[model samples]
Target: MKALVFDKSGLDNLRVREVPTPLLGPHDVLVKVKLAGVNPIDYAVVQLIPVQPMPHIPGAEVYGEVEDVGEHVKGVKKGDRVVVYNRLFDGSCDICLSGREMVCRNGGIMSVVTNGGFAEYMAVPEKNLVKVDLPPELSASLPVAALTSYHALKEAEVKPLDYVVVFGASGNTGAFAIQLAKKMGARVIAVSSKPWVAEFSDHVVGYDQVQDKVREITMGRMADVVINSVGNAVWESSLKVLGVGGRLVFFGGLTGSQVNLDLSTVYGKHQKIIGTTGGTRKELLELTELCKDCRVRVWRILPLEQGREALEWVAKGKDGRIFLKP
Candidate 1:
């Protein structure tokens, strides 16, 4: 098998080369990669995090065919088309039992904890696979990007007519945020430096103009909910634009992580600052339904050998989900 492997965590270290195929565990499924979704976090993990076993493959989102399945596997088998959930958790945990497995105490992500789908084949636990009914190209982009936005919107408890602000609106999860928030009946305010607009959003503005436009649109009431995946670059502005008693659901640290929060301002406005990570299996299942209906959009598809270049595009903050075909 040919895979892009990095002996260590650095952009320069990633290389596409022939490697041994992964052997499946008794309860695992070996998927022949059809499309692998490249996300910003893939770059973060490759360039910032440390992992064991010298060489590593770094792709978390996958749309593939089950080339083989263990005897214990159910719901899906060989030749079944599916998407890998990417989050692994102990089934016995309280959170897992509640179906919010992403927050389990024993949780770890696919690319971060084990080998991933950057290659021609990936072996993952049967529990982490979800059957899908969409083309591999479109299905590739939904696993991580759509699920993250879905999880955030659900966690925020967005109500009909609530004003929602989405930072990085042109990015993968941000784009999905726009649509999902609107579907939940919230009026979406999309922020991006690029020229992008969604029919679902009520307004679109640049970062420099977010505070003013949001205030003008809401008659100074500001946003009822703010989803900030871009991190510190817009952190202060995101906070300032929130209405009193607002909820801010933050997930990524794309720009920079550290931000100084004013406690007085927070309490004065009765604000809620919540943090989220990769979504649970339950949320991913919902996204799979959306995929079947062709509700999500993928920017483009490239070959698996272009994994390095795709990572570069993600690091540079491309406009939407980039898919890679093996």
Candidate 2:
């Protein structure tokens, strides 16, 4: 099998090379990779994270066909179309039992801890596979991008007629945040310069205009929830748009991680600042149903061999989603 591999922690080290096919565990399923979604975290893993083993394959979002099923696998059979859950968890863990499997104490993420779907094939536990009705290209992105936004919105507890502002509204997670907020009955204020953002959001404005526009639209009440997936670049602005008692939800730091916060502002406004990571499997399942007809812009689809280039695009903050075809 040929896979995109990095023997060290650097984007420059990534390359496509022949490797042994994965051997399945008794409860594992071998998936023939069809499309692997490229995300910013893939770049982060290459540059920062210390992944085990000398050589590592870094792709967390997978859309593939079941090539083979292990002896104990029963839910899916050969030729079944599936999307990888991407988050590896043990069902017996305290967090898993409490329905927060995304943070399972005994678990680690795919691609980071285990070799992921950046190859001709990948072997994952049967529990990590979800059968999908959508096309492989589209479903490939849901596990990470859409699920993250969905989880953030849920955390914010958005309500009908609530004003919801999404920073980086044109990006993958941001676009999904706009659509999902609308679906949840909240009026969406998308903060981006892109015209496509208007298709999903009730209102669209550039970052420079977010504060003034949000104030006008909400009639001075401000936003009930602010989704700031873009990180510190817009952190202060995101906080500025939120009304008293509002929730500020965040999951990514694409621009920069560090930020200065005035503690008095949060307490005075009764605001809640929450941080989230990968969503639970339960939420992913719900997202599959809610967003089955979802449409995402595919910026490019390159062959698996061009994995390095795809990572570069993600790191550079390109528009639309990028996929790797294997």
Candidate 3:
């Protein structure tokens, strides 16, 4: 099997090499990766996360077909089309029991702790796979990115007619955030520096306004909820644009993580700062339904061997999700 291996040295150390195929556990499913989703974290992890072992395959989300299922697996079988939740959790953990599995203290993300989706095949826990009937119109390209957006919106408690501001609106997560916010009946304000994003702003239905600058668009009154995928660079401004009692959901730190947040306004304005990670099985299911119904549009697709190229694009802050077809 061909896999892109990452080590402590950085992406320069990444190599395309033959590797042994994964062996399945009793409760695992063996998936033939049709497509894998690359996140900014993939790049960051290469630099920041210490290499656990040589030849680490770093991918978190995958859209694939089940090639084989363990005897203990009941929900899916061979030939099933599925989307996987990258965050693997111990079923008995308190967080898992309470349905907040993504935050399970004992179980973190797949790419960070275990072999991930960027390969010809991956063995994942059966509980983490969500079987869906893939729609002809919906390709594997956008599922993970869409699911991330869906998770952020649900966590932020976005309400109809609420003023929602999405920073980095041109990027994959931001693009979906814009569309999802609109679907939830929120008046969206999308911010992006790239001129090409104008196409998205023009076509996507719910954005009330699109701008290169945040302050100019807000016109003094901030949004009720601000969805930020770009960290540090927009952190201060993101908080600045939030109205009193507004919610700010942070999903990624693409820019950098160190930001000086003013704790004063948080108390005085009754503002809430929330952090969200991956989506739950229920959210993924709902997202699948939405995509199937033509409520969400997939952005684009790339091949799995283009993993390095995709990471480079993400590092440069390219617009839209880049799918890696295995």
lDDT (CA) per prediction:
0.85, 0.89, 0.75
TM-score of each: 0.95, 0.98, 0.88
Task: Write candidate 1's Cα lDDT for 1-326 as tens digits.
Answer: 98888987788888888999888888999999988989987897789987644688888899899998887777787899889998889989888898888877798888887878889999999988888888766578677888898889888899999999999888888888888888789999999776655544678888787789999999999999999998898899989899999999999897889999999999999999999887878788887775454444566688867777888898887756688777
lDDT per residue, candidate 2, 1-326, as tens digits?
A: 99999998887888899999999999999999999889888888888888865699989999999999889899999999988998888899888999888889999999889888899999999999888889766699789989999999998898999999999988879989999999999999999988888888899988887789999999999999999988899999989999999999998887998999999999999999999888988888887799987779889999977888888888777778999997
- Which of the predicted structures, 2 or 3, would earn the higher TM-score when compared with the native? 2
Model 1 score (lDDT): 0.85
**Candidate No. with top lDDT:** 2
Residue 187 in candidate 1 has what lDDT? 92
**Pairs of residues at least 3 apart in sequence or in different chains that clash in candidate 2:** none
Tell me the tens digit of each residue's lDDT in model 3 across 182-227: 7788877767665554544422222223332444555655688988
| Ranking of all candidate structures by their TM-score, best first | 2, 1, 3
Report lDDT (Cα) of residue 239, candidate 1. 94
- Consecutive 10-residue window with the lowest summed lDDT within model 3: 203-212
Model 2 lDDT on a 0 to 1 scale: 0.89
Which is superior by TM-score, 1 or 3? Answer: 1
Model 2 misplacement above 4 A = none
